[model samples]
Target: MDYLMCHIEKEFFGTTFEGIPIYQYTLVNKNGAMVKIITYGAIVRELWVPGRSGTLFDVVLGFDSLQEYEEKNASYFFGAIVGRYANRIAGGSFKIDGVTYQLALNDGDRPNALHGGVKGFYTRVFKAIPMKTPKGPSLVLKYLSHDGEEGYPGNLDVTVIYTLTNENELKIEYRATTDKPTVVNLTHHSYFNLSGDGTILDHEIMINADHYTPVDENLIPTGEISSVEGTPYDLRSFKRLEDAIEPLKDTPTRGFDINYVLNGKDGELKLAAVLKSKKTSVRMEVYTTEPGLQFYTGNFLDVKGKGGKYYSPYSGLCLEAQHFPDSPNHSNFPSTILRPGEEYRQITVYKFSMEG
Candidate 1:
């Protein structure tokens, strides 16, 4: 077989606390966009996209060292792949097949099970495989979650493939299967600052959704699919993030952290949102198969990131595409249940372009 050549460079990253060796795979597309993925947390350490002037900018927030990511990623999530359940679950508990399961109450005093519990997929090291493809270079990460690992039933096998396409798209494909009945909602958590520096408040954004799931004080969905019309949750038109986040400055969230019900057929990939940075003339278009898009301003980001830069609140923004929060508890929301013999699959693409 003739070996196909692709722009994928693998290098040693660092060791985990348990002395586990970690590796980073750098995938470069034909157009020069780059994405670096590490085995630890199956995280995207950095993503470089080109601006209008052809200057490549690292748009995602990350750490300089493995120790920093290990110590601080829990607070901000960074570029990790979060799962089991992407968002909050009410009271840290849910019922599956008439059996109640209690997950770790890791969401501080709010007492909700956030992101699969204390040891979510973001904390686990995955086995990586790099492959050259016609479309681009791909890095496949595989992880096995044992039954009852995070108070969840069934042993879930997960595979996440990150492909850097020639179209300047960072495509993430998620697939999972379980031996028993389980609920799964996997999503990427990457804090993006399209300008590559400073806050994301000035970025213009638009979401292709006419409805949103309103959250309560704890940030859990209120079980009602409310219309985005005449509401602050509306992002149907492009507007500066500063204008959208300013109204909630005194509220409990302090910024946008609600989930917008994506306007499309669930399970079908469609345009979810678009974020633009006027400073760099870079635009990011998000397309996903998930039914909801969580637009979270970095409301609680007060940590220092790579290059010794201090990131204050609203330093970046996250467009997390996944199922609605507390979907297992919300009967009306799209189902996230995955039973034996059923394969859970989702695809999300972040395509970048220069709009001068």
Candidate 2:
């Protein structure tokens, strides 16, 4: 694990749907923490960090090859950047500036548009720039979405930077601007299993949220911000996911896939969540500037990932920091609108460590 250079390397990942070339960028920090990101969809294919025993393990679940990522239909998002709008949009329609826009109904039988109507940022190739930052290695990804590309208004220009600092922090900074009013809720979809090969059910979870947005059967927010007082959604203190989710295992929701309203100022980066694997003692602290965090246990993960690994339900978990789900349709929730002349910026940092 010698990282004297802390170099940023690149290699060919795969081609796009249109047969365009795509590249993978590898960033290694001074402490030997490594991360691999592909230009196609700006996907984070692998992230390796040291465990308590000084063993490096890939914490994020992803396909071994880009071909698998391209051919798979049920992505579960894996380790990609999902955007335009992250969660479900009710009825696949929303009103902006007194005009109603209809999107493609991609979520079957749900009457909603899931993850930006099928062709979201997670499926598109992006322009990447590798760089050497003052603290460590970094890469910047840029993409532009034309007006009405996915039945959404505005020509949006977006830039996201992934920086690996010497202190073992994977910092993600997102900035965007639009020409017309549109809904924008960008979030990273990374299924994390800190123990590398085991289920995340034994992982301890802690969320800094006093309330959460309840959802319907279709997973759309009901526009009510209810307190997490006595419900199973309470993760204010550290609790094993297995114990926290056992009560809801028989319900319609099945498991944890709800959005918790972060307790803090919306625009300031604050501690949102903390996840630790009891087996490996690998800890990840999530800090974000967003208003909410979507905590999803990989309840539907049935894909085969890297090294011929078959991922089962609850194999991994996701802590997606973003705005509330269906924020555009719910006027009571925090707004996800990006108006003309206004800039959209959010920062989320995943700092990793080992518990002694």
Candidate 3:
């Protein structure tokens, strides 16, 4: 198949250390929007979208080769799917039906678990199937997590679909089922810089959240659901990212790394955030079915990205939509527990456009 103009194209990416063959799927839309997804980690390797000048620019930050991901993704996450649980779990421990499960202490200070312990969905090679749909091109990725893997219960079968629609929307749908009770909070970890280069401090942003979860020094939720009023976390209206970060200069959160309680029902998709870059005039609107959105600025980034470009702190930002962190321990938070015969589902869309 001639892939130059094809809506969907698949090619061999690379082989994993386990001798597993991985493939990359490229999905192109009628609007010149394109997305490259790889079976390894079910990651979005690149995203090219039209800007105000009608030029397509790759807007996400990632590496050029599979080896780079294999070596660097453990710290960066990049555009991979983070799963089982997305954020920090207090003391790397949680209880299910009065039984405590201990996970790896992989986060800061070695007191909490981050993104499903040492091995997460981000490290797995998903089985990929590329197909054409009426809406556009879609790639389905599936992975199975065995019981006791990463100290989590049950054999969980997870399926994630990445669809590039005609409207320039990168849609992600996640579904899972477990044989026994388990807690799950999956989210996509994509660091986006709409301008294609430089720090993301100038990006204009807006989040549809009235309250946010307060966190401690460990970045674990303190069980307080506080209002965003009179706080830098308030982004109910459009505000420049630099301005948003200014108020937190002297605070523990030098930059945003907190979860916002989104203003919408939990089960239905709704607008979560909007980000725009004046340099490129590209606008990205995020919609999700989850009740919480983790807005994190790349505060510790200091690495070379694709094309050997040096990425400094705040080079990109991540808006992770998922259930609240440490949900299993917080009785007041939304439940993330999945039981036998029950299904876990979530959808998040990153829709793009250009402003003249």
Candidate 4:
């Protein structure tokens, strides 16, 4: 909690509707690594690291102004924490022990509730506090989702910790407790362009999953776990996103927006994916304790981002770590229900480096 020793700084970010103040906090490690987070939605505004040539540059895509983030178009989740249910829920309804709870259908014509029924955690303000660990400088953000906040059950208290380690790892830890039975899945939404401001099509990517959940036309899982072999979904080995996306660009959805069943024990933090931008010589290794990772290419990403840069489709990508989408609707998938006493926890790490 010692700010001086941790080298954490705080400043004014902006104000919300009622003119309440919002703040931004910057964490710096001894190795010149930096991470910027804001109280609004506990969003990660910028993540900077050194490239192969030892020059620091921002790797995560976002906006310079909070207004741009607040009005981030229809597809702009932008480096914030998404929750309640991090992905899609079919028909916006789920039953728990014979009681059916209906949610809002927010995914356009899909007739599904997407990312916590619209006003998800990404749309709310979080109480942010700074603290440091032996591993690095950290920021802890807390939020209390009142009972029936988004047609979901129970009053949920959630905390998310973002740590910038000296080893160039951005570690995210999530914890939530509910008073009644409820479904909760949380993850970070960051459009990562390792080259910083260019199309991410050329990034070399590899995922450790051999199976994936196939979605219907509406992008809802058909409750089938299919093999990725011989398919463009097969990212078992390193493949250029340009090549992987080429075959699927014609699809109605336009690019890769699939969810991979992470290969490992449910709660063990294991390697999920590795991304390298040869253009910038910047590499990122993704590790997580969650069972599923949603790999979303910026297929519909048309919006103004930092420095007035216009981001287009395939400009950036997201590797969201959490439970599978619509877990409440599928009995076979890993359960996402959190009862009175059971707690929910997930950890994900994004380690950055250069070709060394």
Candidate 5:
């Protein structure tokens, strides 16, 4: 495996309310693929992958300058780790072992904790440690969440490793341990625009999910496992995202933003979804050990992105692998609780290739 790492001096928006300076590290693979990540929020600044013609194009939406990211509120979250809890917690509250805990509500009057609240892991700057492995160059990021930081229990120490292998696989391994029992569901939120030129509506997507969690008007799951058959949510087989997005444009969020129950065994890696962009002939295969995948079509990206373009809705898509939303509240869903004796581990891989 070919391992490559280079340190470049680049400035970025700071973590505090007052803008500060941050650095960016670029990791490139032998296949001419590369990912630029910054220390601020550990955000993925850009990602370039090879196309069918053996050309490289930036596929992830991001900003060119720190000022742009600060002013626009346009955090593609691009390729950052989201955690504590990956999805929404109803009313910013959940009961664990008969103990009710209140969380920080940041989802705009929804009264629910969305994506780990206002000061989520995405908003924190992680400590990056670069390592050389047999497969490739990897970066291990560690973050410590103090008890009651986000109104959750325990002091959580989380580690996420980003490894770009020689086989064109971007593997993310998540590990965490808490001093007290807590809810932990972490995933990498990478907005992907495989076509590299236009919106993701034309991209063909195939999700191996026969059921999905029905959401309310606020985009919170109603704790029901509804069949995806005959609905716009159906993607059991390969289908263009545009074909099913037109009708749902009038819904609450106005796009495909829902969690799908993966039809596979838990705790074992299995194919989650396959995405192909005909324009660039770029294909990506997603595999994970999680039980569910959240498909978000960049429903709120109307803000300005890099290069003076207002990123319209559906400009990018994210497939986050994790346990179902509100799993702590829903007994039917997979358990997301991690006691002191148990360890949390999850692995997800995005393998890129091109179609002839």
Candidate 6:
């Protein structure tokens, strides 16, 4: 496959505690799909794709300035890597191999630990190596996690490759190895708004999931593998996000923020979910080799982002593929433990297409 690379001068919130320069790089594909990524947490600054009318728009919600990201305390993550453990860990604690571990709590008012605590991967600067691969120009990010950092055992070396394939697929390949047993679950947290503006409530979404894990008021799973047969959680078929979100306005978070068990026999690469914006005619199909997919509707984005834009609730949505939340605490959930000599690998593809 043929590819081209370019860099655009852009400043973002500095990565240092004292505030420094934040540089970003923009990579564009032959089809004109562009992805702007920064070294800070390897966050994706912008993702521009062709619309139905041959125009381009930044479909992903992000800040245009670093100060906005720092001031608003944005929870969008905005194309950042979430790790050590993704999603919520109930009670901010879990047990593995008869050993209990306590994690740092950072879920606002909730007691559970979320997205790897206050200073997760999203706040760190990763070492980026731009490579010219046979497939295309890719950016490989490497980060080392010390033992007991964020209360996770074992020293882990993680490598995440972000590749823009010629087929219009933004492929994320995650690989990690640990010297000791550790709970590892990682996924990209990008709030996608294919229409580029307005709320994503009208976006249509479909997940190839027959069962979903029910959650309590705190947003932690109830450990029950309930079928999406008759509830509003049902998305086994195509449905508008607004259709399901409007009725769920009373729930905590007031929008879709639940994890669905991707239905397809064991955990394999299957169609996880498909989202389409009728306004832009841009559609995204997600495929992943993970056990579950967390569909978050950007419910907590009530702060100002880049360019002084205040992102309201449901401004964007995310479909994160990973192990179930609190899997380390629930014995019935799929295993998230990575032992020595075992390779932890996960592949997620976001294929983009448009209709006239």
Best of the candidates, TM-score? 1
> What does candidate 1 score in Cα RMSD to the true structure?
1.5
* Position 145, candidate 4: lDDT: 95
Backbone clash tally for model 5? 0
Ranking by lDDT: 1, 3, 2, 4, 6, 5
Task: Please list the residue runs of candidate 1 whose C-alpha ends up more than 4 Å from where it truly belongs after superposition.
Answer: 1-5
Point out the higher-scoring one by lDDT: 2 or 3: 3
| Tens digits of lDDT, candidate 5, 1-356 | 34434222234444445655666767766666777777666677777888977988788877777655555432456566787898889888988778989998877867778888777887777788877666765778888989998898999998888877766778899999999889999998888999885689999999999999998877777889999998998998888888868878988778888999999898999999999999988899999999999999998786666676567889899999999988888889999998897789999999889887
Residue-by-residue lDDT tens digits, candidate 4, 313-338: 98889999989988898999999999
Q: Would you give me the overall lDDT of model 6?
A: 0.83
Model 2, 207-323: lDDT tens per residue?
999999998889898889999999999999999999998998898666898999999999999999999987888999999999999999987778788898999989999999999
What's the CA error at residue 53 for candidate 6, in Å?
A: 2.6
For each candidate, the alpha-carbon lDDT, in order, equals 0.92, 0.90, 0.92, 0.89, 0.82, 0.83
lDDT of 3 at 87: 89
RMSD of 5: 2.3
User: For model 2, what is the C-alpha lDDT against the true structure?
Assistant: 0.90
| Least accurate 10 contiguous residues by lDDT in model 5 | 1-10
Residue-level lDDT of model 1, residues 226-336, one tens digit each, is 999998888899999999988889998999999999999988989999999999999999999999999999998888898999999988899999999999998999999
Error of 6 at 218 (Å): 1.6
145, model 2: CA deviation in Å? 0.5
For candidate 3, report its TM-score.
Answer: 0.97
Which is the better candidate, 2 or 5, if ranked by lDDT?
2
Q: Which residue pairs clash in candidate 1?
A: none
Looking at model 4, the pairs that clash are none
lDDT of the structure predicted as candidate 5: 0.82
| Cα lDDT, model 2, residue 118 | 80
Candidate 1: C-alpha lDDT: 0.92
RMSD of each: 1.5, 1.8, 2.0, 1.6, 2.3, 2.1
| lDDT of each residue in 1-356, candidate 3, tens digit only | 22333388889999888888889999997777999999989999999999977999898999888888888888889999998899889988989999999988998664899998788889999998887777878899999999999999999999999988888899999999999899999999999999999989999999999999999888889999999999989999999999999988677667999999999899999999999999999999999999999999988888888999998989999999999999999999999999999999999999999976
